[model samples]
Target: MSAPYVLVLYYSRHGATAEMARQIARGVEQAGLEARLRTVPAVSAECETVAPAIPEHGAIYATLDDLKHCSGLALGSPTRFGNMAAPLKYFLDGTSGLWLTGELVGKPAGVFTSTSSLHGGQETTLLSMLLPLLHHGMLLLGLPYSQNALLETRGGGTPYGPSHHAGADGKRALDEHEISLCRALGQRLAETAKRLENNRG
Candidate 1:
C-alpha cells in the first residue's frame, strides 16, 4: 500500500491563501505525514475558455484521484462574497463519484481562508468549504479554544479553521497568530488521521 498522505488543496488568487496552505503543509510534515499540495484552475465565465493543463506557477492542478487517495485533507480558499472561490467549488462539484462511493468517509478534514478585509467573510468561507466535505462523510476538524492563537489573533483566526486578513491591497503577510493557527489545524488533522488509521489496523 502507498504511504498515507494529507492533501492540502486550495485556490489562491492574491497568494495569501497559498501561503497558508504551505504553513498547513509544514504542520502536516511536522506530524510525520506527507502533504500533497494541489490547486484548482480558475473558472472563466465563457464556456469555451479553458485553463492550461499545467499551471504557470504554484501547485499543480488537483485530480479526482488526489482527492480519492488522501488520508486527510486541508482545504483553503480566499473569500469571495462570504463563500469559497468558484474554482475550488467547481473542482469539488466534480467529486460526486467520491461522494457516491464514500471514498472520503472517516477521513479528517479542515478548512482555511484568507480575506481582503478582517470582516470579509473568513468564517463563512470556511463553513462553505466544509459543507461538501460533510456530504462525503469526512470527520471535520476545527481549532479548539486551547490554541492561544485563536484567542490572541488580531488579523484572522477562528474556531471554524485558520484565517488570514490580507488587507485591502491583499499584500499583508500572515501574522504570527494566523500562521500558528494554520499549523495547528494541519497538525490536528494529521494526528487524528494517524489515530484513526491505527484503530483500523
Candidate 2:
C-alpha cells in the first residue's frame, strides 16, 4: 500500500494563497505526514489556452489520483467575488468520478482562501470550497477558537478555515495570525486523519 499523505491543493494567482498552502503543508509535515502540494492550471475564456503539461514554477499540476488517495486534504484558492476562483472550481467540477466512486469518502478536509480586502468574502469563499468536499463525503475540519489566532486575527482567520488579506494589489503577505491559523488548520486535519486511519485499521 502507498504511504499516507495529506494533499494541499490550491490555485494561486498572485502567490498569497500559495504561501498559505506552504504554511499549511508545514503543519501537516509537523504532524508526521507527507505534504503533497499541487495546483491547477488557470482557465481562460477562449477555451483554447492550454497550460503546459508541467508548470514552469511552484508545485506541479495535480492529478485526480492525488486527490483520490490522499489521507487528508487542505484546499485553498483566491476569492473571486465571494467565491472560489474559477480554476479551482473547474478542477472540483471535474471530480465527479471520485465522488461517484466514493474515493474520498471519510477523508478529513479543510479550506482556505486569500482575498483582496479584509471583507472581500473570505468566509464565503472558504464555504464555497467546502461544498464539493461535502459532496465527496469527506469530513470537514476547521480552526477552533482554541487556536487563539482565530479569535485575535484582524485580517483573515475564520472558524470555516484560514484566510488572508492580500491587499488591493494582491501583494500583501500573510500576517502572523493568518499563518498561525493556516498551520493550525493543517495540523488539525492531519491529526484527525491519522486518528481516523487508525480507527479504520
Candidate 3:
C-alpha cells in the first residue's frame, strides 16, 4: 500500500496563497508524511469555458479521489468577499460521494487564506473552508499557542488558520510569522492524522 500523505490543496490568484501551500507542504513532509500539492482551475463566467484536464504549469488538478484518500488535508484559497474562492468551492461541491461514504471521517484538516487587505476576511475565509470539512466528518485542526508565531504575526496568522496580507498592490509576502504558522499548521495536522490512524489501526 502507498504511504500516508497529506493533501495540500489550494487556489491562488496573485500567487500568495499558492506559496503558502508550498510552505505547508514542506512542514507536512517534515512531519514524515508525503504532501500532495494540487490546484483547481479558474472559473470562467461563460458556460463554454473549460480548463485543460492537466495543468500546463504547476500542480495537476485534484480529483475527488484525491480528497477521499488523503490522510490529512491543508486547504487554502485566496479570499473572495470573505469566503473561499469560486474554484475551490466548486471543486468541493463535487465531493458528495465522499461525504456520504464518510471516507474522510476522523481525518485531520486545516485551512489557510490570503487577502489583498489586512482586514479582508482572512479568518472568515478559513472558516468558510472548514465548514465543508466538518460536514465530511473530518477533525479540524488549528494553530495553538505552542506555536509562538501565531501570537507574533503582524500580517496574518489566526487561530482559525494561517493567513496572508498581500497588501492592496499584492506586494506583501508571507512574513516570518505567517510562514511559521503555515508550517506549524501542516505539522500539527499531520501529527493529529498520524495519531488517529494509529488508533484505528
Candidate 4:
C-alpha cells in the first residue's frame, strides 16, 4: 500500500489561495507526512465550453480517489460572495460516492480561503467549505488562539481557518501572519491524523 498523505486541495483564481496551499503543504511535511497538492478545473456557464483534461499549469485536477485515500485534507479557495468558489463547490458536489461510502470518515480536515477584501466573507467561505466535510464525517481542525499568529494577524487569520486579505485587485501577497496560520493548520491536521492512525492501530 502507498504511504499515507495529506491532500491539499484548492481552487485558486488569483494565486493567493494557491500560495497558502503551498505553505500548508510545507507544514504537512514538517509534521512528517507527505502533502499531495491538487486543484480543480474552473467552471463555466457556457454550455459549449469545456476545460482541457490536463491543466496547462499548476496542480493537476483532483480525482475522487485522491480524497478517498488521503490521510487528511486541507481545502482552500478564494472567497466568492461569502462562500467557496464555484469550481471547488462543483468538484465537491461530485463526491457523493465518497460520502455514501464514508471514505473520508474520521480523517482530519481543515479549511482556508483568500478574499479580495479584509471583510470579504472569509469566515463565511471557510464555514461553507466545512459543511461538506462535516457530512463526510471528517474531524475538523482549526487554528487555536494558542497560535500567536491568530492573535496578531493584521491581514487574515481566524479560529475557523486561515485566511488571506488579497485587497480589492486581488494581487496582495499573503503576509507573515496569514502564512503562519496556514502552516499551523496543515501541521495540526497532519499531527491529528497521525494520532488517529496510531490509535486505530
Candidate 5:
C-alpha cells in the first residue's frame, strides 16, 4: 500500500493562505506524516472560462483522489465576504461522490484562513470550510487554548483554527503567533490521524 499522507488543500489569493498551507505542511512533516499540498484554480464568471489542468505556479490543482485517500486534511482559503473563497467552495461542491462512498469518513480534518482585515470573517471562513468536511464524516480538529499562541495572538490566531490578518491590502505576513497556531493545528491533526490509523491496524 502507498504511504499515508495528510492533504494540505487550499485556495490562495494574494499568497497569504498559501503561505499558511506551507507552514501547516511543515508541521505535518515534523509530526512524521507526509504532507501533500494542493490548490484549486480561480473561478471565472464566464462558463467558457477554464483553468489549465496544471497551475502555472504554486501547488498543482487538487484531485478528488487526493481527498479520498488522505490520512488527514488541512483546508485553507482566503476569506470572501465573511466566508471561504468561491474557488475553494467550487472545488468542494464536487465531492459528492466521495461523500456518497464515505471515502473520507473517520479522517482527521482542520481548517485555516487568511483575511484582509482582523474582522474580515476569519472564523466564519474557517467554519464554512468545515461544513463539507463534516458531511464527509471526517473528525474535525481545532487549535485549543493550550497552544498558547491562540491566547497571545493579536493578529489572527483563533480557537476555531489558524488565521492570519493579511492587512487591508492583503500584504501582511503571518505574525509569529499565527504561524505557531498554524503549525500546531497541523501537528495535532497528524498526531490524531496517526493514532486513529494505529487503532485500526
Candidate 6:
C-alpha cells in the first residue's frame, strides 16, 4: 500500500488560500505523515477549457485519482460570494466515480478557505466544500475547541476548519493564531487517519 498521505488540495486565485494549504501541509507533516499539496486548473470566463497543466509556480495539478486515494483531505479555496471558488467546485463535480464506488467512505476530511474580508463567508465556503465529501461518505473532521487558537483568532480560524484572511489587497499574511489552527487541524486529521487505519486493520 502507498504510505499514508494527506492530500491538501486548494484553489487560490490571489495566493491567500495557497498559503493556507502550505500551513495545513506543515501541520500534516508535523504529525508524522506526508502532505501532498495539489491545486486545480483555473476555469476562465471565456470557456469551459481547463487552464494549462503546468502552473507558473507552486504545486502541480491534482487529479480525481488523488482525491480518491488520499488517506485524509484538507481542502482550501478562496471565497466566492460565501462559497468555494468555481474551479474547485468544477473539479469536484467530476468525482462522481469515486462517490459511486465509495472509494472515500470513512476517510477523514476537512475544509478551509481564505476570504478578502472579515465577513467574507468563511464558514459558508467551508460548508460548501464539505457537501461533496459528505456525498462520498468521508468522515468530516473539524478543529475542536480544544485548540485554543479557535477561540483566540480574530482573523480566520473556525470550527469548520483552518482559515485565513487575505485582506482587501489580497496580501495579508497568515497570523500566528491562523498558523496554529491550521497545524491543529492537520494534526487532528492525521491522528484521525491513523486511528481509522488501525481500526480497519
lDDT (Cα, tens digit) per residue for candidate 2, span 1-201: 788899999999999999999999999989888899999998887893367878999999999999999999999999999999988888999999999999999999999999999999998899999999999999999988899998888888999999999999999889999999999988988899899999999
| Runs in model 1 lying further than 4 Å from the true structure | none
* Candidate 3: residue pairs that collide: none
Q: Positional deviation of 169 in candidate 6, in angstroms?
A: 0.4
Over 4 Å off, model 4: none
**Deviation (Å) of 158 in candidate 6:** 1.0
Q: How many steric clashes between backbone atoms does each model show? A: 0, 0, 0, 0, 0, 0
Q: How accurate locally, in lDDT, is each candidate?
A: 0.94, 0.93, 0.90, 0.93, 0.92, 0.90
lDDT per residue, candidate 6, 127-190, as tens digits? 9999998998999999889889899899998999988988999999999999999888888888
**Model with the higher lDDT, candidate 3 or 6:** 6
lDDT of 1 by residue, 9-92 (tens): 999998999999999999999999999999999888786226788999999999999999999999999999999988898999
Task: Judge candidate 5 against the unseen true structure and give its global Cα lDDT, from 0 to 1.
Answer: 0.92
Q: For every model shown, what is its TM-score relative to the native structure?
A: 0.98, 0.98, 0.96, 0.97, 0.97, 0.97
Off by over 4 Å in 2: none
Give the lDDT of residue 89 in candidate 3.
Answer: 88
The positional error of residue 115 in candidate 6, measured at the CA in angstroms, is 0.5
Give the 10-residue window scoring lowest on summed lDDT in candidate 3.
Answer: 44-53
| lDDT per residue (tens digit) for residues 127-184 in model 3 | 9999999999988998888889877878999999999999998878889999999899
Superposition TM-score, candidate 1 onto the true structure: 0.98
Q: By lDDT, highest first, what's the ranking? A: 1, 4, 2, 5, 6, 3
Which ranges of candidate 5 are over 4 A from the true structure? none
Which segments of model 6 are wrong by more than 4 Å?
A: none
lDDT of 3: 0.90
What CA RMSD would you report for each candidate?
Answer: 1.0, 0.9, 1.2, 1.1, 1.0, 1.0
TM-score of 6: 0.97
| Model 1 per-residue lDDT at 86 | 88
Please, what are the lDDT tens digits per residue for candidate 4 over residues 98-175? 999999999999999999889989999999999999999999999999999998989999999999999999899889
